[model samples]
Target chain A: MNKEIGPIEDLIKKLNRLPGIGSKTAQRLAYHIIEMEDVEVADLANSIIRAKKDTKQCSICMNYADSDPCEICSNNSRDDSIICVVESPKDVEAMERSLSFRGKYHVLHGVISPLKGKTAEDVTINQLLKRIENGNVKEVIVATNPTVDGDTTARYIQNILEKYDDLIISRIGYGLPVGGDLEYYDEITISTAIQNRRKLD
Target chain B: MNKEIGPIEDLIKKLNRLPGIGSKTAQRLAYHIIEMEDVEVADLANSIIRAKKDTKQCSICMNYADSDPCEICSNNSRDDSIICVVESPKDVEAMERSLSFRGKYHVLHGVISPLKGKTAEDVTINQLLKRIENGNVKEVIVATNPTVDGDTTARYIQNILEKYDDLIISRIGYGLPVGGDLEYYDEITISTAIQNRRKLD
Candidate 1:
């Protein structure tokens, strides 16, 4: 019953291998690609290839970027003394979107997941340590996700950075987000919110 | 707040242009693509380019294929006297998956959608007429979707083929799909099913 033509089938298979694309979505995308203008298709392909070829990890922060130092690392106006540690480059984008964090970022590339076989050695923790050791960084903020592996990675970083006598290690607050309702939040979040409660200023 | 890097943002915009891929999904896919091995990334890009470059509309049936006539049109064992007309290549694939349609296909590429300004001339209705006129075709199974445009296109085709006394133009049955419950079906589908009820054999 599998009577797909060669090029179409090949495209579908390639698309299906992506992170979130299912077989049905791959099929839809393949057909849409086939129907698109040749110039548009070429542009899409060129962008994919160009992005892969041009992008490199920032040597300092280990974040994916077009240059070695990355824009944030090169910018002197940003607070170089404070570094926000995150699991991926996308997290850096999220933090930047918030517009509140005026510091550099160190991308861990991944969290420490025992079940997934990702360890401290697998991530860019060594690069982060190297940055901290070489720079006059005063504060390190762990902005990894709030999942189990996120907490584990945060604690692991805190343990390793404890030797830095003057450096302040902080984890981003764990609680309901802005505009979130108490009733919609889970018990763990509610408890965490209560535990981290502060007096009115 | 828009401090995204050049190549990364370009890749995200290109990916976001694809159907069903939102900004968030595009970000995730872009990051995933960046993390992928160089060879895998090249393969993915190459496949996209190759699919577009190699594919051509079949001269006979207007279906996208690497070859001129397409596999289905060139297959000698398939019933040439009966043609299955569908709206797109994906629909042809769906019909092929059913394993019941043992005939060649005619891809309309689109249907007559007044809302979308797609008329009979926009689709390959002329190519279909050319196929019917030149061949010893006896039956044409209109397997277009059960949308308003689909019905309009099917009726338009029927009206055009009325001059051919020996031709059997039939619309594919529209009713509850296999494993579909009556309660779950919409009012229109339930009524259509009852209207087209067959004697139990």
Candidate 2:
């Protein structure tokens, strides 16, 4: 009995396609949007278009950027000799949030997920290797996620880069997250934490 | 240490302004949008703008519509004499979903909330009275939510319309939702359900 409103329905369907938005949430959002001021709605629409059109993949790091090299890649303060390789641009952002890494980054775009038919050739693995082959790079940290695909991708990169005797290829440590409770942690995490236990400073 | 990507950050900020989206959810959505195909992102953005530009409020019912009168208002089959008055355009959609109500709707836009400084004069009460003044309407059902403001608004409307001798003003029934367990239901709901109970057929 619900009479269809064409444009609003279209908007709701479009919103429902987003990662976490459900059909109900989409409906709520659509109604909320209709209630919003015209100028505010216009601003939201313009921002979406601007975000899509203005951002480009950084040629050097393969991260989303407004500029070719991106702010991190072009910065002289960051160590060019050390590179932290990650799966995606969002991963680079997460790494940066830790505020400890002063090194440059290489974004692989994706991991080698065989189940999904994503091979090493599918992502920017060659581009990452090309960045490290410049001879100036000494430390190459493989900071991909701890999933099966992440480990496979890291291993593949490590196997190829093994000839570089001076370069240090290290995976980011995997253990219980900081401030995490021991009782709540899974068995693998607890064991890994024990295996990678550090000396008291 | 997370260096701002101009357009992406702006988009995230814009998304965060939405009713239910948190900062983290906004960031995730922004990233997802960036990952989407150019055509898909354009479609999504265009839909937002189109929804805003296309819809107009029905002059008769004050519901959102592509046409001035709205589909429901213009439908000759719908019972105009029995007007179902509710808060907001979304409430009209909710009512339509039930499929039992063939009557037309009148959207009040908001309830009289004294806490929020909204009075009976602030909403579309005058417009509602004007509609009833035409002598065509015989029954007016107040379907505002079961809140303090809802009760106040319903009472206010009922008091004002009492002068119309033939008009029957009624409020929507409040009871336990379908498939809801009685043990989980609040005391007020159980009491209301008992008070409004109908005899077994």
Candidate 3:
């Protein structure tokens, strides 16, 4: 019945475009949507539109926010001397979830991926360098993911920031995840975790 | 940062309501939604709203459709005398994908299950009986899923349909799925497949 170009089919196609969603999942989502109240469905639709329109790129950290400087950048308690550099706003959320870092963040919006034709210019590399060169920032933490692009991006940023004599650039270590089984870890992860083993307090 | 009831957080909550979407998946979908063009995301939202607004239950078969009687029920190409009974709209889509059934469908919207407190009154059993009695229907195919609930529903329908001496009521066979491995099939499937084996041409 949905083989026709009806609204249900259209919704399915649109839902399938989201990451990790396939045709089957999209279909299920569409059916579930039909079951929801009209007001609730409208709220969902309006939420998406409002999120895009109201959320701006934070001038300091480049994280998406309703305010210009963002909550993190404006917070006086957060350390201004230390800045954690990440690939995206989602990474900022991940770091925040850990609740360990009480410093500022710089969102690159993406990593350096040669395969995808993304280079330093494509990301916020120049802005990161400018922040360091402006002085007062003591340490820079490269908190990119463990993927090839993330590592490449981290290395590239480190190389550039090394020119600033007072700036100390460090990388977030790749280690066995907390509570992860050693036997289940991949070879590369195990080796890296071993190589970057930290001294126990 | 998104722990706040911000736009991103709101979108995540909305996304999590969809079937099979957990909090993590919802977050991923929310981020993906932000990456998408405003027009595209708006289209997805509007499509869901439009689908619910436009599609109505067909009076005859009780399937969701743009108009009463639905396309299949009105189409002369479809076999009017033979009706396939299914639990949901998705099941009708599955049957249509096979292109095997030219006959129309009757969507009960749910299956009979005592655990869930569903009874003959809960589903469209009366409508199905009325359709058969009012029309010149020759046979009824029970195409509910192969779950415990599906089997229970099929058996209940069969018991009631027995009163109509002229109508033939049949259940779709339970067997090893075509191209499925014999070694991996459960005992019930293997046994049922053997018993339901038919004469080949």
- Best by TM-score, which number? 3
TM-score of 1: 0.90
By lDDT, the candidates rank as 1, 2, 3
How well does each candidate superpose onto the true structure, as a TM-score?
A: 0.90, 0.89, 0.91
**Per-residue lDDT value at A189 in model 2:** 57
lDDT of 1 by residue, A1-201 (tens): 775548888999999999999999999999889878999998898888888889988899999888988888999999999888888787777667556678899999888999899999989999989988999998887877767788799889999999988888887666757544323444566446534533211
Predicted structure with the largest DockQ when compared to the true one: 1
Q: lDDT of each prediction vs. the true structure?
A: 0.86, 0.84, 0.82
Distance (Å) between predicted and true CA of B38, model 2? 2.3
Report the lDDT tens digits of candidate 2 across residue range A36-86. 888999899889888988988899889998888888989998899988788
TM-score leaderboard ranking: 3, 1, 2
Superposition TM-score, candidate 2 onto the true structure: 0.89
What is candidate 3's TM-score against the reference? Answer: 0.91
Q: Compared with the true structure, what per-residue lDDT tens digits does model 1 show for residues B1-201?
A: 766548889999999999999988898898888878889988888888888889889999999988998888999999999998999988888888999989999999999999999999999999999998999999999988898999999999999999999999999999999998899999999999999999998
Error of 2 at A26 (Å): 1.6
Query: Residue by residue across A72-191, what tens digits does model 3's lDDT show?
Result: 999999899998888878777766765557889999988899999999999988887787767489888776776778778878887887777777777766585643433344556644
Model 3 is docked with a DockQ of 0.71
What clash pairs does model 2 have? none
lDDT of 2 at B149: 92
The DockQ-based CAPRI class assigned to model 1 is: medium
